[model samples]
Target: MHRSAPRLSRILACAAVPVMLVVAGCSSDSGDKKEPDSSESSASASASKKAEPTVEPAKFAALPDPCKSIAKKTVTSLVPSAKSKSGTAATSSDTSYRAGCSWNGLDDNGVKGSQYRWLDVGFTRFDSDQSLGSGAERARQDFDKQVAKAKVAEGAKKIAEAPVSGIGEQATKITYDLSKTKEDFKYATIVARTENVVVTLTYNGAGYAGAKTPSATDILKGAEKAAKEAVAAVAGTESDKPSGSTAPSEKATDKEDSPKSSDKDSSDGKSTNRKTSANKSSVKKTS
Candidate 1:
C-alpha cells in the first residue's frame, strides 16, 4: 500500500504542473489590453488624410488701358467742292496748298467718279542733304524711290496733287486715279510738318466705276487730323519742344511707321483687360 501511494503522488504532481502552466497563461492574457483593431487604425489614418486641407491656384490682375495716354484735339479739316470735269483741281490757302482729282470712266457707267485729294504743308523744303534736318525730305525721297521702283508714277502723281494746309506753314494737295494703270487701286499721300515733327499720311483704295467712285477725301482728312493730333500730343507746338527737350524718341518714330491697329483686340502688344486666374481668386476672396 505504501509503494502504491508513492507512485500515485508522483502522477498527481505531474498533472498539477500542466494545469498551473495553463492558469498562468490565462491570467497573463486577461491582464493584457488587446491591440487596437487593424480596421479601426486604418480608418483613423484614412480620416486624417481626408481632413488635410486643399490648396487653390492664384489669379492675376487685369491690364491697364493703353490709349488712355492720348489726348483730344481738333485734328481734322474738310473742304468740299463741286464735281469737276477735269481730273484735277488746286487750292492755295494761307497755310496750305491743296489739290484734287476725279475720274468718271473707270468702269461701265459714268456715275462712278473716284476722287483723290491731298495736302502739302510747305513749312519746310524737301532737301536732298540729310544734314539740313530734313527728316521729312529724307522720308519723302525714300518713299518716292520706293514708289518709282514699284512703277507707281500715276499713284505718285495722285499723291502729289492732294490738298494740304497747316498752321504757320504752306500746305499742298494732289489727287489722281490710282487705277490708271492695270492695277486695281490707287493711293494718295500727304506729307506735312507740324511745329515739332514731320508727318505723312497715305490713303489707298480701289478705283471707281462710272461716276460712283470710292471717295478718299474724307479718309485723307481723317488721317491728316489724326497725324496732327499725334504730333501735337508728343511734340507740342511748332516752337514748343517736347518735355524732354530732345528730339522725339525712337518709339515715336516706330509708332508713326508701324501699321495702325484695325481693332481694339488686334493684339499688337497693347494692354488687355483680361483677368488671370490669380485675379479671379482675389476677386473671390474680396467677395
Candidate 2:
C-alpha cells in the first residue's frame, strides 16, 4: 500500500510540472506581443504630435543697416546740414529682425526762417514660420499697419494717401501737414514691402523762424525714391527698378494696349484698301 501511494504522488507532480511550463510559455508570448504593440503605438503618437514643415523659404535672410538703407544722395537731399550724416540708429535687441535710424537738421538762415528737416528709416524682417505664414505675407500685413499708423500721427492735418508704383513689390506714399513750434510742417511717409522686409520712411520738414515750409510734392518724390533704395537693400539687388510702373499688371496692360493699337492700325489699313477699291471701280466705270 505504501509503494502504491509514492507512485501516485510522483505521477501527480509530473502532470503539475507540464501545466506550469505551458502557463509560463503563454504568459511570455502575450507579454512580448503587448510590448511590441505598445512601443509601436507610442512611436506613432509622438510622430503625430510633430509640427508641420514650412511651406516656403524666407525671402530676406537678414536686414540691412537702417542708417545705410537709403542712398547718401537721398539722405543729403532730405536732410541738408544733418547733425549726423551717419544717422542715429534706434536701440533694438534684435537688429537682424528690426532696426531704425533717423537724421535731423536745422539749416539756419539769418532773418529768413531756418529750414528744419527730419528723416527716419525703419526696417522689419520676417522669417517663414510653419504656424504663422510666409515671410512676405507677414511683411505685407505689417506694411499696411505702418501706413495706417502714419496717417494717424498726432497733430497731422490734410492727410493724403496714394499708391506708388515702381518702387518695390508694393508701396504707398502718405502726406500730411502738422503744426509744431508755431510753424507749419509738411510730412511724407513711405511704407513699402519688398519680399520679407517692410520699410517705413518718413521725411518731414518745416521752415522755422520765418522760413517757407517744404513742398509736399518734393517730399513725396524724395520719400518714394528713398523707399525704393531701402527695398533694394533688403533684396540685395540693384536699386534701379521703376516704382510700381513696371509691375506685372502694368506689363500686362502694356501687352494688351500693344495688341489694341495694332488692331486699330490694321482696321485703318483695311478701310484705306476699301477706299482704293472704290476709286478703282469708279475709274473703271468711267473708262
Candidate 3:
C-alpha cells in the first residue's frame, strides 16, 4: 500500500505537467494582444502608399481684368461716342472666375443721321477640379455651351456660324440680324477658348433717322478683331505673375498638357492668345 502511494503521487505529478503547459500557452496568447493592432496599422499604411494623383492640375491660376482687356484705341473705333470710354464693368460675385464689360453710344450727324453702336465682352475662367476635370477641359465644355447659346439668340434672323482661326485655341463667329428699339441691328458674336478661359463678345449697331445700315460683313470683322484682343489679354496675365511664382502642381499639369497642346497648335506653331495686339473694347446696350 505504501508503494501504491508513491506511484499514485507520480501519476498526479504527470497530470499537473499538462495543466501547467496549458496555463503557459494561455499567458503567451494574452500577452500578444497587440498583434491585431499591428496588422491594422500595416493595412492603413499600404492604403496610403497606393494613393496617387488622379487628375492633372489646372494651368492658369487667375484671370485677367475684363475692363482693361482691350486697348483704348480699339474701343474708340468700335464706339465713336461711348457713354463711358472706360466701359461699364459687369457685376459678378467672383471677378476672378467671371467678368464682363460693355459700351454704347450714338454718333450723331445732323444731316446724315445718327449711327448707333453697341459692344459687349465677357470672360469666364475655370479651375482644375477632380470631379469636373482639368481647367482646359472645363473651359472647352463651357465654350461649346456658349456657342450653342449664341446660335439661338432671341429675335435673331439670318443666323450664321463659322469656325474662325488666329484668335484663340478654338473660336467660332456667329452673325445675325435683330430688330430692336425700332432699328435693324447687325449682330456678331465671337465665342473663343484660350487655355482655360472663355471669351464671349457681341458687337451690334444700327442706323437711325434713315441712315444706311452697317454691313453685316463689317460687324463680323469688328467682332473678330475685338475677340482676338480679349484672348491676348488672357494670355498676357500669365507672364504678369512673378517669375517662378507658379505652383509646382500647375507646372506639372502644364508639362502633361504641352504635348497635346502642341499637337493641336502645331499648324501655327504659336499660342493664339499670345498673338494679341494693342486694342480696346466696349459694352453692350441691351435696349
Candidate 4:
C-alpha cells in the first residue's frame, strides 16, 4: 500500500507541470497581440495632433533692376526746399535730373536724342498748386485739365492690375489740341508705374494736313521697362518709399498733416516753378 501511494503522487505532479506550461504560452500570445494594437492606436493619435503646413508672406526678392532692362534711362534726386503761407509747402531743392541714354526715334527725321531732364519728387506732399500756371485761377484750370485728361482713376486701375505695388496714383494718357500755329500739333502722354514711382512718356508732333507724326508706343514701352527697373533698384534697398524717411499714407492724410508754413515756403518753391514751366510749354513733356 505504501509503494502504490508514492507512484500515484509522482504521476499527478508530472501532469500538473504540463498544464501550467500550456496556460503560460496562451497568456504570452494574448499579450503580444494586444500590445501591437495599442501601439498602432498611439501612433495614429500622435499623427492626428500634428500641425498643418503654413506659408509666409510674399517678399520682393532680388529682382533684376528695371532700369537695366530699359535703355536710355535717367534718375533724378528730389529734396525739400521751401515753406508756404498756409503751412510748410514741400518743394524740391538741390534737386538733380540725371540724363539717361538717348532714344533714337524710329522715324528717320524724328529727333535723335537720349532721354533728358528727369525730375524726381523725393517725397510726395499735398500741394493745392499742382496746376501748371502762375496765377491761381490759371493754375486751378491747368490742374483740373491735367487731372481730368490723365484719367487718374482708369490709370490707377490698370496699375493696380500690374505686378508692381499698387499704392499710388498714376497718369497714363493726355491729349491736347493746339491748332493756332501753322505747325500745330497734337500731343499725347502715357505713364507706367512700379511701386510708388511714375514714369511718363510723351509724344508730340505737328498734325499738319500732309505731315507725319511720331507714334509714342516705342517710347512708352521703353519708359515702362525703365520704371520697372528703377523700382527694382529701389526695392533692393531697405526702403520702398521715395522719401526714405517718410511713411506711406492716403492723400487725405497728407492734407490733414500738412507741414508748417516755413517748411512749405522752403520746399514748394521749386515745385511751383516746375508747375509754371509745364503750363507755359504746350508741348506736353514728362519727367
Query: Where in model 3 is the C-alpha error above 4 Å?
Result: 15-53, 240-287
Stretches off by above 4 angstroms in model 1 are 1-163, 180-186, 195-197, 207-213, 237-287
Q: lDDT value for candidate 1?
A: 0.39
lDDT of 3 by residue, 52-133 (tens): 4556766666666666677666788989999998889999998778889998999998899999999999989888887788
**Clash pairs detected, candidate 2:** 113-211, 165-243, 165-244, 166-242, 166-243, 166-244, 166-245, 167-243, 167-244
Residues 1-287 of candidate 2 have per-residue lDDT tens digits of 98899999999999999999999999999999999999999999888877555558665666766777676667878888899987899998988788889999999988986999898888887888878889988888999899899999998999999998987889898899999888898899999888888889898889987788889888777777777777776665223444222111222122323677779889999999999999999999999
Tell me how far the alpha carbon of residue 62 in candidate 1 is from the true structure, in angstroms, after superposition. Answer: 33
Off by over 4 Å in 2: 1-7, 49-51, 55-57, 107-114, 127-141, 209-211, 237-287
Predicted candidate 4 versus true structure: per-residue lDDT over 113-205, tens digit per residue: 222112211221121222332222332343345335454433222221122233223334444433344544343444433332333433334
lDDT of 4: 0.37
lDDT (tens digit, per residue) of candidate 1 on 90-149 = 232311112122222222334555433332221222222324444344434544443343
State how far residue 162 of model 3 sits from its true place (Å). Answer: 1.8
Q: TM-score of predicted model 2? A: 0.68
Candidates in order: C-alpha RMSD to true structure: 27.4, 14.8, 13.7, 19.5
Best by TM-score: 3
- Rank candidates by TM-score, best first: 3, 2, 1, 4
